[model samples]
Target: MQIKLIAVGKTDDSSLKELISTYSKRLSHYCNFSFEIIPDLKKTKNMDESTQKGKEGELILKHVNTSDILMLLDEKGKSFTSEEFSEEIQKKLNTGMKQLIFVIGGPYGFSPEVYQRANQKIALSKMTFSHQMVRLFFTEQLYRAFTILKNEPYHHR
Candidate 1:
């Protein structure tokens, strides 16, 4: 199965970009991994939080295929240990899924419509993290998960 991470807004920090790139390159050895950025909305000076999210939601949905499994990185979602996460990844791969898409929403979070489209949700931590940081953290964890699956030295048990 292919894995894709879709996040809103551009990551401006060069350091973070480099780190994310590093993990992404490592991930390519195990599976087809993609990081897609939905550009931040412009002309939102008068738009409310809900309205902004709704617009972002529309764009987020556009990339999804009916057969793809959509997972949201949400604050209220279930949190799993690193080993458990690797197991979950294995389960998905076993299903022969075409694509497994995980979305990182904008500052205001996901819209009602986006939530409706999601197949499930997973939380990284109980503490809050910036959208940009989440991208880096998620990428690294995904890389680690693959390493664990392959019994590689990259990940220590």
Candidate 2:
């Protein structure tokens, strides 16, 4: 299955961008992987939180397809161990999924419409993280999960 990671906005920090690129390259060795960045909204200073979220949500939805298995990276979503996440990925592959899209929303999180469209939600941790930082973290975790699936030494029990 093809795995696509969609995140809102760009990563301005050079270090974070480098790390994300590193992990993304590492992840490519195991499966078909791609990272997409949606441009940040303009003139958000005058908009309310919900309105900003709504606009970001619209951009997020535009990248997704009806046939894609959409998963949102939400704080209140289900958390899984490294091995368990690998198993979950294996299950999706076994089920013959065509595309798996995991989205990281904007600072205020996803809107109600985005939530309704998601097939599942996954939480990386209980603590909050910057949207840009989450991209790096998620990419590394994805690389680790694939290593675990391959029984490689990259992941330890």
Candidate 1 per-residue lDDT over residues 1-157, each given as its tens digit:
8899999999999999999999999999999999999999999999999999999999999999999999999999989998888998999899898999999999999999989999989999999999999999999999999998998987774
TM-score of 2: 0.97
TM-score of 1: 0.97
RMSD value for candidate 1 = 0.9
Off by over 4 Å in 2: none
lDDT of 1 at 137: 92
> On residues 71-136, what C-alpha lDDT tens digit does candidate 2 reach at each position?
999999999998898898888778787999999999899999999999999999999999988999
Question: What TM-score does each of the candidates earn?
Answer: 0.97, 0.97
- Candidate topping TM-score: 1
- Highest lDDT scorer: 1
Taking the candidates one at a time, how many backbone clashes does each contain? 0, 0
User: Candidate 2 clashing pairs?
Assistant: none
